[model samples]
Target: MNRKTLVLPAVIGLLAPVLAACGGSDDGGRAGGAITVGTTDSYTASKEAPAPLDPAYAYDAGSWNLLRQTLQTLMTMPRGGGEPVPEAAKECGFTDSGNERYECTLRDGLKFASGDAITATDVKYSIDRVLGIKASTGVSGLLSTVDTIETQGYKKVIFHLRTPDATFPYKLATPVAGIVHPEEYPRDKLRTGFKVDGSGPYTLRAEVKGDTIAKAVFTKNDRYTGQLTPKNNSIELRPFADADAMGAALDKGDIDLMTRTMTPAQVEKLSSATTGDVKLTATPGLEIRYLGFNTEAPVVRDKAVRQAMAQIIDRGQLASTVYGEMAEPLFSLVPANITGHSNAFFNKYGAPSADKARQILSKAGVTTPVRLTLNYTTDHYGSGTKKEFEVLKTQLDRSGLFKVEIKGTKWTDFRADGLDGKYAVYGLGWFPDFPDADNFLAPFLDEGNFLALPYVNSAIRDDLIPQSRREADRLIASDSIEEIQNIVADDVPVLPLWQGKQYVAARDDIQGVEWALDSSSNLQLWELSRGVSG
Candidate 1:
């Protein structure tokens, strides 16, 4: 799931089983043209409605994009037509010196839906504001490498960095760089629960937060003059609280698209349930899952204990039992098909062997009383997460070397607890910065490693990162990545569980379903359409 290069989601075609729900008496009009998508995570309106829209403080990807409508970036994705182009800025090449300064120009007539000209001041306010509010949650980490962001003019933005990071442009492409409304938010105060005001194609129409249901309906902004080529003219994003409930809604034909959490069996149910009418397509995604260790923990400080734990987990059984066959065993931090990735951890610890695991812990003098608490998120991923953790507890307990205790928390509590290094060991899943190896490396390997594995690899932080980001040649980049992998293996910070697979079901009549790209499963939204069967 982690990768060293810009990669898209893996595309896995569906193995469908025709079922009752997806099949029904078909009338002449194409299967009720509107598609109903489902997801489990319930969305909430932070009193500000979407206030943290400030790029320096924006956290979620969707809200970032929505607010980006009003803001602008210097460059965009798809070197030459990757997919839907962003509004705001046009593409330009950076200096090969890696991290060398560069500039971008905004397309003519671009302005906020509010009629405010998107000048460089807005860009400066969005980026520089991040460094100003670094103390807030996730803001500092996102703004770490940003040395300085300055505006040359109304349309041009210049970024001078503390390091020569060639990947800065791509980072800008992420929602993290989504422009913000300077008129609405102030830099000093991290605005929370504020409505998102952007120049994007859609505007926040309404919100419903009670009962843990948050929904935002958007309509075309006549004032918008950006790159987002809208197809449907409007979209509605609704967040559901439960994954199973969301799945049921999809089966009952309540939404058009579903992206969140779904087990393999449930996926199979949807694919089969739809028969040929409900199309299920998978894309290689930047979405990644890993086991994180809190270095502050005494037991985990021992290399043998960590190594032994890495050795005994059976990914194959775990995937099938909990995630179903949809989950694949992940061996490396960087995902497959991405550059700068290596299975070093897998090379160090092969298949499971509890007997051998016991010996390692015993040799390390970790007596029977050695107890490890495994933390699991009750609501973040999906329904089977708790059960999966229970299985992990069983495996570790069966070893008889260490007593394992299982703990569960909702996503909010889990994130706070995990970030504070409260749990000795926890699980993490990443979507990616921009589907690049740098994203996988920078966030995890930099001075402040996320898992509380505080590793300060000066070479990686200073030399390797700059060198890799600067080099365009894939082969040379591979060498730098190999070095990074070697260092990761030597340190053994995290164990890669598996690259998760997502199943998306749409009506057969829908066209332009590329189901590709490993970045984020958030489709272009513009690429999908429904009409008469071909």
Candidate 2:
């Protein structure tokens, strides 16, 4: 089920001498003057933490959103909502009885940002590039069902799927499908520093890396002329080593914009600071928190064992203790806003009960404590993560029926460890690709999907996903997604924790800060520029 909305929180300026002391920009609305943003998003430019301008590897939230906006997909939701908006392709239709042969008719007179006329060859080359780098990129898996991608005229491209996929167009509208200049981009790395060439509104102009790089300034993309909501000529994306240091930098007028590692405590502190020039936006929607149990492990394979363990989690108390009132109990993998999601799990599980858990364990012939290891990313999910896990460990240990060992790993390494089938228990947070049941269903259900968890459920993997993909109706798609989720809740291989709250800080001068489906919340720079500049 596909759903979309455009809403960004706005606050009036909190201007004072204190705010001026910290920075020039007010914390209220944005006016598009000089803006310095700060965020604690650290990424290394190496093979392990490789820097990829290519959209296919746009896995990280920060990079994905920018690349998504900078590059144009063959089709897009102009409002960033539902279905394809036909940015590149004017008309799209389906052929073949199984709905596998999808054809598209494109709009002519389009050119790459580099001034090269777009052609069917360019389309082929762009897609073929991702298909080529399937191994290193991790993008190959997202497109595994594709049999072939063909082009008819300079404007039209047809995708032949091994199986029927109705939601393929939605996928096409995603950043992963971002079309790049075929002439410049070859099999591997992007050519130069932020020098992007695409048929989008914005064109990459200048990108200064660090104080180490030649230039240390950010500027507007020259090629951007497409109808956009662009408010600022240039938006600066700066990474801070830590949130505290970044917070200090923002106070000292060192940065203009910020994201990543933003928490409630930080927002509360920064927003209410005597220097309250920075606007803090309260973003809403599916920022999900959950505990993923490796079902493949022999210890978790037993349903009684897993269910008993889930029963021991004090979700309500835990939510209050770790997340405070900012979070809610997640009963289903799909959030309430997502189509077809109901509190079905809540109806089934209810509040945590230790007596029932002990009963289940006793029935399973488990007399002693169930020893388990819980894993999480130390630096990725902000400072509150380890504390949150500590609460969970305490709750589980309080049951007196289980022994828990908590393990923390860095973000990049934690994923590799999961892929190696190393951890039996781990904490995972999901920021959706799109606001739909499909995003919830596919990620958690598909065995070949994320974490490479072998969630081999034929009904979900083979039937449900294919069924929802072909059925274009959102309600129908939601029904399929809901049925699949019921299976997930019953399986209890993973336990729901809490859904997160999105926060963004803008100056009173700024406006039009739209939240993207993937939780890549940035100022919709176009819709918001200088608002009544003083």
Candidate 3:
């Protein structure tokens, strides 16, 4: 998911500003205690996201974090991350040898939060509405391969695919495939407002301030008939404007847990501090940051200019100085931890070298001191963004082969400008829709990519991507995946920066802090509970 703004496809929108203290008071106890969770993320009901929580429209992690609590998908990832497993469905699998047809049988006596029965029709309708709406900010692109959905009787649903896509089940595990009641959500338009009517682990009651989601209260849904069982009776999610504000809330006992968008300073303090009751848990993250070039732009459009910039930027210094070593220097579009990952960029560029950058520009017959404008969001991706860009500008300037100007704007305008191709180069972050190499590469390199960049590579997009998706065994797709990375490294449409680590800061008495987030980094609030001594 796009990290900070509305991502066009399966990208996540990161943290935003919202009211901090608006949820229910925390009731202290053991397992069933009401847990208060805090984040800096916010979602607004706008053209980009007409319905902040509608399964068909909400594409940001903040919205998905809440949606996963109230909406059940046909399939879901296991708690610690693995293959897609049956959740609402009793069984699901590819019905054809070509992986073109998928079928699922609904569990008996399934019911929505409103007590309405969840049938195969609801499953078909949920997917159909998502495809029909085709919201630019929605994850409809994830289901583009599906030709049509067919329902048999009241329990069986089948999907006919236009192409052989073995990754379809992983797509189903995402919030984009979340089931919505037919009566609550419309057929062709997004259902607006802050209410949810699905039969997930929780029933939601949210408070909104204008377009900002101030707070959300989740009560355990007694009608939920899924594999997950709630560890707590209730949960209260509060949103803050920044890391400092959220850290203050945690320090003062205003929140039982704090996660998503924790600053490097905050993580360092929590790691070293021995006086406070706070504890920090870090996990290998799928979140990645990169520099996206507008291939049609005047200056960065030149392959030499893009290559020179890539050759000069120092990822090790950037990660250590700016992120306090919380993030790892990334060389490939796919994260290092994910299968089929490769160090293609590192293999080509080697260490950061200005001499090599000058030679590449010289060989391409491009004039020296090429001018470029780099853009980034001011409020998104934490407070270090400005400093990050400042450091980037310094690095490019030091090369003596380029003149770089960095600009900052609010996330809404920044995203709009980037999509409109207003900058020569801009920074973007990705939180995967699913944990796969395809999630990282396909969304950025494919035709009509989420980045809105004019990067077109027929071999990688038309052949390699489809080839990889056809393999039921993802391990067998490594050759195709590696070839795609090499092509990306050569084209230089987007330069990989750093891969971040997921951090959750919670009170020492909080249980299951490590298991609160799923593979795609979506919060599973049901896993959170108070310890016996809490």
List the global CA lDDT of all models.
Answer: 0.61, 0.63, 0.82
Worst 10 residues of 3 by lDDT: 1-10
Q: Pick the candidate with the highest TM-score.
A: 3
For residues 433-516, write the lDDT of model 3, one tens digit per residue. Answer: 888898898778776567766789989877999999999888899999999999888889999999887778877666666677
Span of ten consecutive residues with least summed lDDT in model 2: 11-20
**Candidate 1 vs candidate 3, lDDT winner:** 3
Q: How accurate is candidate 3 locally (lDDT)?
A: 0.82
Off by over 4 Å in 3: 1-33
Clash pairs, candidate 3, are 1-11, 1-12, 1-431, 2-11, 2-12, 3-14, 4-14
TM-score of each: 0.86, 0.84, 0.92
TM-score of candidate 3 relative to the true fold: 0.92
Off by over 4 Å in 2: 1-34, 78-80, 93-99, 136-138, 188-199, 203-219, 225-229, 269-275, 514-523, 532-534
